[model samples]
Target: MGEVLYRQYRPQTFSEVINQDPIKRTLKNAVEAGNIAHAYLFTGPRGVGKTSLARILAKAANCLKLKGGEPCDACDNCVAIREGRFLDLIEIDAASNTGVDNIREIIEHVKFSPSSGKKKIIVIDEVHMLSKGAFNALLKTLEEPPAHAVFILATTELQKVPATIVSRTQRFDFRRLASSDIVPHLTAIAKKLKYRIADEALILVARASEGSLRDALSLLDQLASFTDGRATLEDAEDILGLPPFGMTQDFFDALITGGEAKSFAHVDSLIDRGFDMAQVISSLLQYLQMVASCKIQGAGQMESGLTPEDASRLREHASSATHEQLRRLLGRFIEAAEQMRYSKIPELPMQLAVMDFFAELQPQPSSTPSRAIPKADTRNIATTQNKRGRPAPQGALLDMREEIVGKWNELLEKMREYNHSLISSLRLASVIACDGETVTISFPYKFHKEAVEQRKNKLVVEAVMEEVYGRAFRLLCLVSAGGLDQKREATAEPRVVEVASSLGRADSLLDEAMKVFGKAEKPT
Candidate 1:
């Protein structure tokens, strides 16, 4: 097989490392000022040029007559180091030889001066992997090395490196290359290699690489082989196993508006295609997050790796769901993803999650909107359901010919606990006429007459009557002396009464007194 693209074209000079201009500038100035440290630590994520830059820095330090703070790439020292044949320069992979014995060898070599170059250089990659004993063995040399030796250590994890070693060296942090930076670099490399690749294909590779230039170039190399030197979007997708962007969006829309059955269908199809449940959920979460981003910052500014058409589809789906609804859905998917690990049937939980999401959403009413009750009208106006099953017309008067005395003495007893005065008047009155909506009561005295005329009292009595009979009725307080006299003569013999109870009297009071006094004289 041919040499891989990442290794075949690795950066050879300080200017070639991408997305780390700050670290390069500082190192170059240090070199120009002749202030290079005896030991240096280069730390960052993978494929960010930690080891490669260490080699370059080593060549620059040992280069004869360095200029412009950069190595003279044409010189014997630079070319020998680049070809990995420099006698005095040593590169160790600490991952495989992390024991103290490997470190002891280096410590012993530090006693000798440079044989061919200006300084003997040691580059230990993944230095964090060294055992505690090995680190201890290297500590003395690291603190006080030979004047002709330089140490350059590189690691991806900075936290694992001991503070003692870190405190004794100069540290440089290399940043990951950004997508915008990685894309152009990959595009250029693709063209130089005579491979046909589009900008979108390059972008996909850049995003998948996730800020590592070497990973991007590696992916490009893989794609070139898979596509027979013509890398296209389909080739990238096939190699990476990424689902089409449109399918994920349609899955979301079908879940939201297409009902439970359609959503189940979509999930079945996804399963049939052998898509991993974990990958499906992860992609769904990312897609929902993209929708949420568009909701917050307009759709014109989504940063997802999706194309314009996919972004448009996302915005359209988002329009159907409110922010709260989407938030709830996201939460459900997260919970499902968590439980998916322990689930016997992963699709079962995911399917129920979708069903539950739809089931929880309430459909709006079609016709009447709920409203508060309006204030009631105030009138002495009484309404009744006549024999014809309709409201009686206005100004309907009560007929008084039928005499039906109300049997309410027990009711009167109950009312006395609430108000003794209302029950006292009720004791002296009788219902002489009754309509379904109105009742006429004849009061024996003016006090009773005045008490019943109070609207609050009348309303309370009317409400009680409605509760008792299931009908609304009104009360008429009438004072009558002749009517009481006529009833006394017909029912029983009249009797004389003494005038001992009279204290104060109005004309209505006198009329009310005679009516009740006359009724009391009747023989039962």
Candidate 2:
């Protein structure tokens, strides 16, 4: 049987390792100077070369013939270590053996000297899997081990490892390999294996790997076998289950062009093709991110893997969008991606996200004037309401309350266009009273009241109020256990009161006219 590509192409020396240049240089200099740390910790995401570097370090420490801090792979010691036959080099899978007893056995072995090499090397992969007692057992040995013993610990999650263990070791963090690095590496390997793979195919593999070199190689290995040592872009897409680049681009264009039907058509087409909804959202997000990057930093700053044509297309898309629009769309798709995980219907989240974004772009009614109240003023009104008492309604104020109560349903209907969730919370609330500046709403449920009282929700409610009533009014939410009727009766027909200075602001003549005659009709 053929050896797997990842195993066959593992880096045998520091120079061969991809990326993490700083860590490689430091470790190599230390090895050459014969100043190796007794305990070394390598932390990073999986498949990025943490274990490969650990093995190389072990071989370098005990290599009979070393050259420029790199182990001479031809030497017997290096060969034995590479072939997994070295007696002094020990590898422990901490995941499976995480008990104190398992750790005790390693401690027992540390007392002895190397059987074959100059230094005894212990490599514990996934070291964070060790239990508390196991870590405690290993802590002392890591802090002060035998002069001839060297401990190498590697973990993907550094937070799981105790601080005591981390402090005792020399920590080197590895980074995920970049697509630029992974591409050439894959190309080189493909050439060595005499495989015919397209450049686009390699790029797709590199991107799909998400910075894991081992994963990229494994994907290449799968592609080679599936396509009989020849792979193309379509093959990679099929194997990786990624949407076609053009389809992703079109979908994003639909979103940017505000073509709700076109966007939904793209999603439906993807669903019809049996594509994973999460992957579809992810691909859109990646394309959106690329467009955003191009918009902000130019196409030259885009990550590697784009064809010249792709880069040109991205630049064109970037021209059609503002940075803020791209940011908001990216946020919406990200939310869709997260919701897809829990959704029973896979495509629903993506569809909803699309609908929501387009809805935001929809033009408001002509009767509703542009927002005159600044966001800061709204925030101030909300703050003042929370810190002070609600003043009783006067004669005109009572008439205004009646008008608002009559149009309350109309307000909810307008609010539905902005936020359906806010409408849900607002439906539970009763308009108990309305002064000229503020509308007091009472909710039977505390949670419902709190939901409407949130800054964003309150803004939507107040904006909808302005749309329905032809004037701006702050919303004051209160939880009333005795219901709206009792709360209204308790304060009914109270004496006229002056508006608080903080809550009252002078209204423009136009606003006053609109409040009295409603918005004026445009001339025919």
Candidate 3:
């Protein structure tokens, strides 16, 4: 049997590395110019061919018959290096042996000239994993090495590599392969292997690989072996273990369309299939982002990363969801995902979180029916007064309170848009005192008061006040000094009445009956 696909398929020459034309061209030119740096730094994400390119550089630098800055693969030095049998070429896994001693050994080895090859080369993979001490030891060799010595350091994480080391080395950044690049590569490989893989199936693998050539190839190999000679879309998905990717967007749509029955069932199906709830939430966030992007820049100009199917679905979902609604749902999914990490009853928290949207879908209560009343029979308005039996001062403060009362419904609407639970709590707050410029409102209990006093809640109150008053109004939440304690305050209060009024005969009879009944109430 041939060697494993990833290894046997590894690029031997610079031209064979995928998605790295610029780096290959520059390195080939440098080799032809005979201006190779003593130390080279290769930085990029995984599977973009950083280390592979480093190996190719090692072979190219050591090849006896190097021409046009490219390795003569038929030469003894190039063949030996390719086979990992060259005495002059050393490949070190810095992640495994990241110590000063490992670096010291390399520095010591730099003194000797090549035994057979034109130059002795060292390739260190994951150089960011090297210990601080090792990095310091390696710096001297990087600063100046023998004319016949070359060093290639590769790292996925560029930030972790020491600045001193980085500054001394010639750097080449490897970019992620575009899907355009990835598709052709996967197709060619599939064809060469005699595997019957569809273009769409290859595209799926490429999309799932996320710009990693090795990952794409490995996934391809896995799918190939799993399906024998043929790789189907279903086989690709089954092996890769990702959701349809459309399911998240579908669930988002179902929730928005008030498809209550479908929403819960969708979650159940996802959970039953062993999809991690956290990952599901993450996918939902990603889906929301795509929808938002599509909304911002219409379907014709989506970001390059999105597939055509993803772009179409995003446009459809974007049409159904308003920006405000999308913002709210995104907030909710984020909250759920955060809570899922610490929740004791995992499903309950998420379920309650989602149920919030369901409640929005419930039919609103109808307005109460009313009968007309005579002018004399209608309730009279009470005069607001101070403790001195004098009318309270009125001006801006009075106008503010009146503004809040008149626009109370609008305020509550805004609160609901921000967060439903906030509006639910705010419903219990009562206007305890108002002098016009500064109005005091109080919640019936401390819990409700604290909830209202939160920074976000305060901001919401400010926004509503500004909307109604056409100016800012400061709201003071207070417990009246003599009227009510912070707790045990009634949300509703009856107006005080003077002693001049008298009850009718029917009311008197009802009072007498209530007195008699109050005395003998312990029948149980």
Candidate 4:
């Protein structure tokens, strides 16, 4: 029954257009100098005033009383163009009629003078949608249009348009409106409509619009109607399907401060409120990024568009954590975002991410002192596990695991000389236990396990071990359940004396080690 907000307030002059200063200036200069090109191309993101500017260009060039290369709103040419009743100003939806025949219709009329206005303006919106043949048909018309005819083309996707067409036309890129620009515009519209909408509501709408002023107005209009002109931030957020800011803050505090219960509680609230898990994770990532930026660049940046007090609260919350911690938390949140895409219960990914962050924060034991093995001897560290291989005592296996852990990297490198893919498979596998002539290693992924246990790969692994030990050892590969996180821990480090007593050849290894370390192996 009424005009939409975006259409109701479309800009009628170059000066009135929002946030496209360079484009406006260029077009205005051309008009003022009577240097208008036969064809003009406008390229930019959607909802950034491409189509609107094309219409304004038409009105400006054809206006009876053009001022400084801009159309006067009072002029007959400008008013009719604004009201969409100007006969000489033709707007074609190239998206619907994208064939050669459709383009020929325009070419057939090119020679005719303006029906009423000074210029015959043809505005082709989404010109990139025109068929290849249609573009070919239109190219000639654009290249050599009648003196009184002007062609204006607009496209959201600049690359799809043929370069030949682009080169012939004068080009202008429309820039997106910033939130700082969007917010005030919405506020002014709300005031004009006599809506009691809060500034918070306007900011939410502006952010949700993401630089699209048309979408921003549409959202504000929705909020105003839903609230009967008493719109609040909560109403705006609910209508826009945004996650609650308070919950995001709570979740951030819980995750960074080792409050696992509070973290899950916040997740529960978000799930109960029907907010998407992806949105929650996304908001958390943004929150951490802002806090990290504040820590590095000071609170002056306020990149998240939060209120000053909220920013201060964020800075205080982030003060307890180091930049390294914030970065790690951000990483976990990002990982959870990807996982959410494949997860059936989307909240499960976020929950798992929360658990992992807390687990990383858990205190770790001190590093156990290790004996330096000879570089040549380091390759003896057995690679991985297969349950079908030789078995041994728990004590013996634990002792061998200590040896394996000490030189795991060396073992992997030596195996790499035989088969790099074998070594790559082993990267996902870790020595968990051992036997007299066999070692047990667990692989996190089935593909790695399957790849390593392939008959040929298994032989290479065994050969590399034999080369290292001067004796044969069976290669065993086991698929570890639950992936890398579920891989078993290495055995506890035994005392040096105990290690020597158990290995027996630890005495020989120690003798070889003495030359390397240039020191005697102490009893401790």
**Residue ranges of candidate 3 with Cα displaced over 4 Å:** 259-264, 278-315, 323-524
- Candidate 3 achieves a global lDDT of 0.68
TM-scores, all candidates, are: 0.62, 0.73, 0.65, 0.69
Extract clashing residue pairs from model 3: 396-436, 397-436, 397-437, 398-436
Best by lDDT: 2
For candidate 1, which ten residues in a row score worst on lDDT? 366-375
Off by over 4 Å in 1: 255-264, 277-282, 299-308, 317-524
Per-residue lDDT of model 2, residues 1-524, tens digit only: 98999999999999999989999999889999999999999999989999999999988999888989999998999999999999898899999999999989988997899998989999999999999999999988987799999999999999999999999999998888888889999999999989999988998899889999989999999999899988889899999899999889888888888488988888888999999988888888878878887888777748466678877788899998987678768866776776676678888878867765664454422111122122223222222222256433244554666677678778877875787555544644555445567786655445566768889888888888888899988787654433224444334212101122224423432232223223332211
Ten-residue stretch with the least lDDT total in model 2: 492-501
Clashes of each: 0, 0, 4, 5
Q: On residues 385-417, what C-alpha lDDT tens digit does candidate 3 reach at each position?
A: 444646444453344355555666677776655
lDDT of each: 0.70, 0.76, 0.68, 0.72
Off by over 4 Å in 4: 259-265, 301-309, 325-524
Q: What residue runs in model 2 are displaced by over 4 Å at the alpha carbon?
A: 301-309, 363-524
